[model samples]
Target: METDAPGEPGPTAERDATIEIDVLVVPDCPNRQLAEERLRQALDETGLRAARLTTRTVTDGTTAARTGFTGSPTILINGRDPFAEPGAVPSLTCRMYRTQDGLDGAPAAARIREALRAAAAAGGGA
Candidate 1:
């Protein structure tokens, strides 16, 4: 197999290029900034700094349902919710993530990184 050169795009790089990241939040969501910051850190750590990132506002239940938004500060990796529990339903509310310590408003950077890597590996951008 061909190997990537230094400073060149590797398999992960190619996969990251095709990944799309979306942060869905409601107006005045308290955790939006934290979620965004963690996401940015994860992208940078994963060498996906150039990945497409979009922040969308979910103002109402209609918009939430239309966009498959489970809650405010929901992070979507290639349109999939890697952190969502089974049977999660769209709603206009703040989302919580279960961390090692306890529940938190925003997912940890490591979690985001894992999600990004998984998405890339799974050919999620398609």
Candidate 2:
């Protein structure tokens, strides 16, 4: 693992090997759990279990804005918000995820898998 500080060097190599994941959500959204399951399934499908998985609850618009939390189930790899696009609108309401079949609350498991793999290849993001 690498660290910004000159001598910190981050966690041990083994400890740092795990992929960092963030599942950002809001309290009222009904898809939070489904999002978690989907992410886990994606990780399993991609054989990325060594990576770490985490979840965060967005309490207010301020936090959402600060984190650019699109809505419930916004996944972040490392410190970057992979689900967020350059010109996407920021809001507190529930968000819709685009899937092959149609729009849905939960992102497709395969899409999550692809995002995870891309994030890993990108060296865990900024």
Candidate 2 per-residue lDDT, tens place, 6-123, comes to 4454443333365688888887679888888888888777656667888888888888888878877787877677667577765777878888999888888887877877766666
Candidate 2: give the clashing pairs: 19-51
Which candidate number has the best lDDT?
1
Off by over 4 Å in 2: 1-18
Clashes of each: 0, 1
Angstrom error of the Cα, residue 68, model 1: value is 1.9
User: What's the lDDT for candidate 1?
Assistant: 0.84
Number of the top candidate by TM-score? 1
lDDT of 2: 0.74
Instruction: Write candidate 1's Cα lDDT for 1-126 as tens digits.
Output: 224688998876677678998899999999999999999999888777768899988898888887789888998888888888889899998899999989999988898989987786686552
Q: CA lDDT of each candidate? A: 0.84, 0.74
RMSD of each: 2.6, 6.4
Q: Over 4 Å off in model 1, which ranges?
A: 1-10, 124-126
Worst 10 residues of 2 by lDDT: 7-16
Q: Per-residue error at 28 for model 2, in Å? A: 3.3
